[model samples]
Target chain A: MSQANEFWVVAEYKDGELQEVTLEMLGEARKLADKAGSLVGAVLMGEGVAALADPLAHYGADRVLLLDDALLAQYTTDAYTTALAELIQEQAPSLVLIGATANGKDLAPRLAARLRAGLATNCMTIKLGEGGALQMTRLDYGAQFQRTMVCSSTGTQLATIQPGVIGVGKPDTTRQAELTTVEVKLDPNKIRTKALGYLKPDPEKIDLTEADIIVSGGRGAGGPDRWPAIEELAAALGAAVGGSRVAMDLGLIPWKRMIGISGKSVAPKLYVAAGISGASHHTGGIRGAKLVIAINNDPAAPIFQSADLKVVADLREVLPATAKRLRDMAVSDEQGGQQ
Target chain B: MRIVVCAKHVLDTSIPFEIDEESKGLVEDGLVYILNPADRCAVEEAVRLKERQGSGEVIVMTLGPAPAQEVLRECLTLGADRALHLLDRAFDDSDAYSTGFALAHAIEPLECDLIFCGSQSLDEGCSQVGAVIAESLDLPQVSAVTQLELGATQGSVSLQRKLDRGGREVIECSLPAVLTIEAGINEPRYPSLPMFMEALHKEIQVVDLDALGVRSQEVGRRGALTKHIGLGPIRPRTKITYTPESDIDPIEALRLMMSGQTAPSGQQSGDILKGEPDYLAQQIIRFLQQNGMTPEANV
Candidate 1:
């Protein structure tokens, strides 16, 4: 295994930090490359990202290529694509892996097109098959079925891996790699897209995937009045608030807070359901939770069948009571600790 | 100005799916179809641009079998001026690469000033064709555009792209580019009765690989750069065990649970509280108070 015969992971940087997906991809790439009897390399871009190469090597990259330039600091399609596509051409690696972030999604297809290469986007898994052919598995039709794609043997294989699906490899501080800087000649006039500024969302909103505990509401939550109670419970329990697909579809909540087959899949420590009927689609998402406690008006609601604890009570009453209970318990625990 | 919106007629994913015994792919028989939700957003955006300009032609296009004409017709009813249907059996099993190749070739002669597409179709969710077509046509593209504003002359597109990391990036690009729209860009309007009727009789220009000057080998699965290998089940990482306490009083169970007292072994069916509302409420309060989950009231 050598640099020319290695699999490449395109390192992604944001807010002066290497994105976790980039490390996760490197770990995955290491596995595939090892299976193929190849090595792993990484491509880093941005004005001051050269130092980011060491961590990439620790994660698994055997070699790191840096394109540090002021023009490359912020990601614009043309400049990055031109530079990366050129590198791919020069290196002609067997496979290239990129994170399926907004930037990666925009970059992968364009690069694939330039090289006439096969691309698989939002892949959950990648493996090396017989004769070292690249195989990828991705969710299709909103996870209704999994499609395994085999990259064509013609050119370099490209794939954008979904974030959070692959586990990050433990960093080996002892590992080191050779770092190389590549020069890119970018014509300012050829750059068609100009980024103006970034707009940040309200910081209070929690991403469901990152939450350890979740309090979710569904159609059975009644209406907007019950939403506050759900939020209150979540706050008391130090949990994030989520909604079922019906709650989101009816405009009761935003799409990002939705959880189900078509929405974000979560594996929280504790998943407390309020007034949810528990459609199979919803259950499909929460099956990974460590524990499921469901409260609904109907004892026989489908959610009960899947729950470890089933409480048949009106959510409007049970939610507030549960919140009050958790709050009191926390206060007493604090008092006992002081003594 | 000419705006072309690429619409996809996809199998309704909400329903059940079965693998075809013969093709080993999705079963097509008895399957319901609809315009992809994201593509609907693209069509709506195209129509809005056309209406705003009030002097441009908006064309809705799709490359699929005969049934795909329905999606184009739906777009026509949404106010697109015409439609382009790339219909042929040779178009079957096409991957995003060849599909983009075919579309880029078909659209080249049309000389479109702007091209719109859904971020990704639900069936495959690859989210690739727009960028591929843009690359094939050598145009710059913006993907997952949530907000779009055209310059006064419609020469450039200023867009806000939603990032996965808690913010949005505003980017400006020259026209004659591709823009793939996500949902929430616009609410697609329902077709009025008169417009719906007019759209049915409207002509759709159908083209095949021969007509589009694409070689047969370069249009379908033969033209694809990737192939579907097989399918497998998505396994859950954790398993749930029940803690049945239906026989125990809820208050007792709550006290036992909070005290970290172990329930007897072989616990299975979980707790099921049943009583009148007032009684249940009182019992719950007692349980909470005993578990130190509620404040000690005027007992």
Candidate 2:
């Protein structure tokens, strides 16, 4: 293995498939490597998962450092951190990027502590700055403000990238990477945390990030009892439903339904903001939206300032009424076509 | 059973906060600082667990400036038995890794049976401190717990943790472990007026790096692995406002909406529209049809 500090990305995989973020991180690392005159390496750990390296290579990795061991088959905080930290120490990596998922959130900090490295959490952008320093930007104070952070020139620089922030380049089947197996010496006694089992949530839960059209309710959205109208409008538009941070904190909606900097980031072709004041935290996540429509009783709501459409009316009345109009239009269109 | 809860005094995220240009940190003037909302849940959970046993001590700890003493007192008023403030300028400019290191060092001597921390700080939202502390202390960490129940058997606990896509992981762990409580798990109870008044008089134990047996160079700016290089605003986005904020008829509003649509440039944003839901509904349907949003738009 080359002794130079390589631009490294730890691949996240599940259910015998590589997660999309892994490819996205590799793609990003490829760009950074090209600029800094460095090599890109991907650390993929699992049992009998060497085949997955092909996809990582196809995405961006120049070499795949495979750590295949039964101890790592299931993710326990202890085993994964120990194995990766050992490899990172020996390989002398300059920077490490991880996806900001649940496991990532749990793993990144421990590794940082073990390695005594710097960690920038939930970064939306990454770039190498002056003096060959790794500079990253993230929305903070609930995404209302943006700040750029720099990692030290000393030890390994570490960061966790938010999902969907980095673009995944088109894969080239012709691309290939060198696969090198790294031995994982894990003692079963050191593993204290055990996975009891996963309890699946409702199968019908919608992923707000991937929705083409999204209808979100916010501060003015009274409660679950008042949510039906919003739901009705979403159904009429065939869009996924979401709620704002205030709605989720008030227990009017589930946490996963929250649409804000603290929650999920979404980019839909059409977005309808119902009873929302459009605070920067909520608006920050929707920057990628193509078209925005705002509905509120108060015409002075901040949402109207940037929305494509503005409504100065009560959402409770407008939502269901709009849904009814949509259905009626569809029905009448069918009749008009027959004529 | 003895339980220790880690709390933070952070800027109230409900209000707007500005960054200090010189220090590259928060400008602390005119801003209300409260115990982190998420940490409040952890403190509440610790108090409730103590109350259930009818006999246990809840100790709250924090690593921050002297003003952080107030947060420890707040925890006390909320029913905690003791408070410890890890105060030192030597700990400044510490990131999640260094911050957790100092906290773990302070907590090691307490020899508590359980440790509680908020899943993430409201201001930073790193979601790493509790896990980092666990790692430093060589204990198992269960994070972002929504539902927690202490078993009748000593040293046994059950929890439901948040997973990706709204799923949950059922976890069963033993005592002497670290748990990061999720927000909205349980309603945090406010202290009574008398309790609040009493908390003011209670003494807050202040400890520095020397007291914690950690060297100054290990946690201060000198020891930090991450540094702030730049501060700036986000990418500028376009903004337009509707004038004469009067409620208009549904058809006119729909016309305005269509006119203002995501035009390339130079086109005006539509007028503000307000009308009865019944009438607005009709106009919206027509608008969708014209915009190709309805099912039969292609036709």
Candidate 3:
């Protein structure tokens, strides 16, 4: 059996703050490093990003490779691909893992092409296989099935793991590791692209992907004017609010809040869909939820077919009542516990 | 100002897909094909550009089987002035690199100032075609364009490109440049009655490798460098284990319920707030006041 020398996890940072997926990848990488009897290295690239090394070390990285440069400050495909390619060529880790975010999706394919390596993307789970190979599982056919793949090539085995798919264990603050800062040479002229300014959406708005619970409204919610009930329910539960593409097309919600094949994929603990007809396009987004509850005025709505719980009633009448009931139950439970 | 919009026919993403046993690829048994949504957007943008210019012509082109004309008709319905279909048996199973090569060769004979294509096809999601076509034809290419403005007198076009960081860059390039339109770049217009009727009689000029003066060996699957080796099924194993709270009483039925091995049964009871309209109205008003909201602010 071939033993891997070093295991590497590409730590993603935005605005000098490490993203949650980076810590999640490090947790998985540490497990693989233990099995291979090798040290785990975390690769951090960006300007003023060296400060993230200590946190990475706390989260199972034995050493952090810091690539600090002005060009690296913003995520341009050219600069990232160039820096990652150079680091892989020099350090030559046995396995590399990245987050399957938008930035990672664009960066991974380009890096794989440049490095001449095979990559499995949007992985839900990854583990060390026999003969020091990496086994990865990702959704295929629009989240219909989970496809497992293994990278057996000699070069770096790359896998882009999806966020919230794996458990991110608590960091071990006691463990301190070495931090090595490296500078990458970048040519500004070769970068055909430039970063214009970022348009940040409202941070107060819930990100559908990270929400533990989601309350979605559909066409049956009457119209765009009736979204307040949906938002109220979502706010009461501290859940993200989502809408069907039909709702988005009708201008009830922004395009970013649409959930379906063309929109964001979500995996929440509880998904409460109100007035949804459950079109296959919209169902794709809620397939990952642990529990699905559907409420619709039509008794024959397709949503009830896949729902774990179904309430055949008018959403206009039922949603407000349901939210009130849940809120009262919560308050009563708090009072009972105190007594 | 002749504009060429390159389109691709892709499997409808709204349906379920199975893997073919023979080729180890997606099975298209019950699949319906459509002009890739982004490419439809591209065709719409090109048609809009032509309408703005009034004298320019917009042509839609695609490389696929003879049946691919259905997709070309869609472009015509969306408002392309003409259609060019490059169909042949040899082009089957071709990768992006070879497809780009064939497209560049086909357009070599046509007089075109600007070329547009979908940023990426949904099936492959490669996003390499526009760049590869640019490299093959030696033309400047901008990808993931969200906005476009053509300057006829200046012989240049300015565009807004979607970058990785949730931002857009405005770039100006000379004419004869290729642009790949991103999804959500524009709302593609549906076919009108007149356009739909006209598209039926519109002739789609079919070109093959022989007619284009290109050797058959220089195109199609044979010219492709990358090949699919094998496909594997994706399976995820979910292990659910539940632990009980330490302070909880250890009764047999309660312990079993807490294990969570079996799914929960029915909904638990909740506070039932029932009353007539007057009582309900008063309760609602009280709740709103407690929440620091007034009746006037309810709307």
**Ranking under lDDT, best-scoring first?**
1, 2, 3
Every model's TM-score: 0.75, 0.73, 0.63
> How many angstroms is residue B75 displaced in model 3 relative to the true structure, after the best TM-score fit?
2.6
- Residue pairs with colliding backbones in model 3 are A146-B234, A147-B234
Candidate that scores best on TM-score: 1
lDDT per residue (tens digit) for residues A1-339 in model 2: 554658999999877678867877888889898998888999999899999999999988999999999999878778999999999999888889999887888889888878877888898778888878888887777766777888763768888988766655677789999999998899988887667788654423557876767888987886765678888888777778887888887776788878888998887767889888989888888877766778888888888866767778888888887888777777898799899
- Lowest summed lDDT across 10 adjacent residues in model 1 chain A is found at A201-210
Candidate 2 yields a Cα-based lDDT of 0.81
Docking class of 3: incorrect
For each candidate, the alpha-carbon lDDT, in order, equals 0.81, 0.81, 0.72
Residues B1-299 of candidate 3: C-alpha lDDT, one tens digit per residue: 88899999987767777777787677767887888988999998998888888888889999998778999999998988888898888888776556877888887677688889898676655565665565556565677888888744477887777643344566666668778898887898878899899998887999887876777776776765444444556555453222222233556446445643222222211122344433443443354345333312222
Alpha carbon lDDT at B68, candidate 1: 91
Where is model 1 more than 4 Å wrong at Cα? A203-339, B152-154, B235-299
Candidate 3 has a TM-score of 0.63
How do the residues B1-299 of candidate 2 rate in per-residue lDDT, one tens digit apiece?
Answer: 89999999987888976778887767878888899988999999999988988998889999998888889989989988888898899998777767788888989999998999999887778777887789889888888898888854677788888777566787777778999999888999978999888888777899898899988877767666677776656653223222333245767667657754433211125687777777766666655555566755422
In order of listing, the candidates' clash counts read 5, 0, 2
Candidate 1 lDDT score at position B129: 92
Q: Tell me the lDDT of model 2 at B207.
A: 87
